[model samples]
Target: MRHVDPAGTGRAGAQAQPDDHPLPTPGTLPDTSVTDPAVNHHVNPRTDDLAVNPGTDPAVNPGANPGMNPERSSGTNSGVGRAVNPALNPAVDPDMNEVVGRDDLLLVTLDTLRYDVAAELAAQGRLPNLARHLPGGVWERRHAPGSFTYASHQAMFAGFLPTPATPGPHPRLFAARFAGSESTAAGTWVFDTPDLVGGLAKAGYHTACIGGVGFFNRRGALGSVLPGLFAESHWEPGFGVTSPTSFEEQVRRAEQVVAALPAGRRLFLFVNVSALHQPNWFHLPGATKEAGDSRETHAAALEYVDRHIGRLFAAASARRRCFAVVCSDHGTAYGDDGFTGHRIGHEAVWTVPYAHFFLDHGEPTT
Candidate 1:
């Protein structure tokens, strides 16, 4: 389903999602996304199958308990003997598999962060958190797959992050199956499922999502599309794209999930950081949340996001065998070339910051 670009563009764009709907608290996340007759609607804080807790944060702290059993992922429909399914077999010892150890993968998409803003922050050491992991990794500028969240993510989950400009051939770390590209590249992880979430599940990883922006809120039929790909998904009213404290709330929840994972389990964790998206004037000095977004405000927002990201990185770094990919979904217009918002063709909205690196491990390997 294609949606008209919120910023107004003549070209086709991503489908409109329930991001326009009133923000719903966690647990009470609207069921308007998509309803399968077979989908269970029961939700209880005590039940593991559909337990959801809403409005649990009063302050941002990364060490809080998740307050629930870590979600166990069942295998994708593909037929293969998976390594572990302890939820089904309580007697199975998780440590028996010595050959395969922790392979936790993390993807943090900085929603609506501009490339130039990031580069500026990195150079000034303002992003000292993510900067420590930048050595010998891919930090080049690239065009986003789409100008907005819903559109770009569809391409990203298909194993396309952002392609390098002036490129003859670009190497991909994770490759999704497509026609004619039947052969696998050396040292590259290959996925044959409909999307990366399914692919990771086939590889014996428990996948989860912590959403930030409205597009990811699981509000309407299209809203659930991305999060639905995971075994478990999380979102809250406080995690909205415009919320100043959304990233902090996300980190708190992420810390819970990370610590709750049973030993010897691999995690595929995905998050969308919404602080820099819009209504970002709150990040600027003397500017309130009610003010319009501006280049000055956007830069300040990135700094706010980076500070909390430091906390998140420290938490994830403590975990064993974790890998991370941090990038922006797309940039927004800051009155450049007379463009004030994203979606129309402009370099400000198209270019984004991208970095794929490993965490909790030693030096990154190619």
Candidate 2:
């Protein structure tokens, strides 16, 4: 929320401003013993009051404790709700009642992306919008219950993602289920009934899935997995294509899906981006499908996918009431320990990126 003036005078040893604006060029470093000229001369236009009292610390009253301010302890501090309040509870309102209007959920699955790649892109500002929404936390370290896509997605919808190892086989499987299940539940399985998506639908959410992979596409029995998971689903022949034109087609269909949402109703949209899968050379700028490619080409494909993802977020932000979860079903191995793609026991095949973003909404508690 801060703003910086790019044309302002440089403070030799001062820290960079908190705004996204450009900063002045670095020159000779300033002497730490001397006060910064910018701080001494620069005047805040928003405030007219300026007082400098020698030998007095403004942060703490002289009559109060040296470590704590009496005003803050008495709840009489003027800066109570400002940025530096110690008692500010950012996560207290998880239901997001403070934000008015309808709420919607968007879950995006970017297939085959690794956690390292996501961190690199995020550091480079390629995902500036997503970075702004995140609270500077780790978004890629969450584990998947299964190394493969189908099994992992099944566990995700069931609300039992992978966690650290357990003591025994029974405990491991119990970790794979919805927590808080009664021992005398009707079902024979250790898992609890009603997955997250189903629970959302039962709570009046309109659930929909836009399939993207061969496992999700309506080719054989694999097609039934995704469709049965949602209230409505769509799978086309070009759904999982790796071509550039196919990417545009998928975006077009996504636009149509967003447009079809009824007014005054909350919707849950799940989409899988398949352009970064194997045979992804066509996603490059001048590459053709016939030309075999390597992991370098896959990186290019991921960059392209990032751009499209930015577009998707832009569209959803326009709606102003959407929550987005972007992650990979599983990672792909590019000859790491002699493994090619996923479905194998390789660290590269299991460590995938995961990011959650909420637009005009607070964190999701359910």
On TM-score, the leading prediction is: 1
TM-score on alpha carbons, each prediction: 0.70, 0.61
Query: lDDT value for candidate 2?
Result: 0.52
Instruction: Please give, for residues 214-242, the per-residue lDDT of candidate 2 as tens digits.
Output: 76664565755555566555556566755
lDDT of 1 by residue, 26-108 (tens): 87864333222221111111112111222211112222222111221222312221222223221111221121123467889
Clashing pairs in 2: none
Compared with the true structure, all predictions reach lDDT values of 0.62, 0.52
RMSD of each: 13.8, 22.6
Task: Evaluate residue 137 in candidate 2 and report its C-alpha lDDT on the 0 to 100 scale.
Answer: 46
Model 1 residue 92 CA deviation (Å) reads: 38
Ten-residue stretch with the least lDDT total in model 2: 41-50
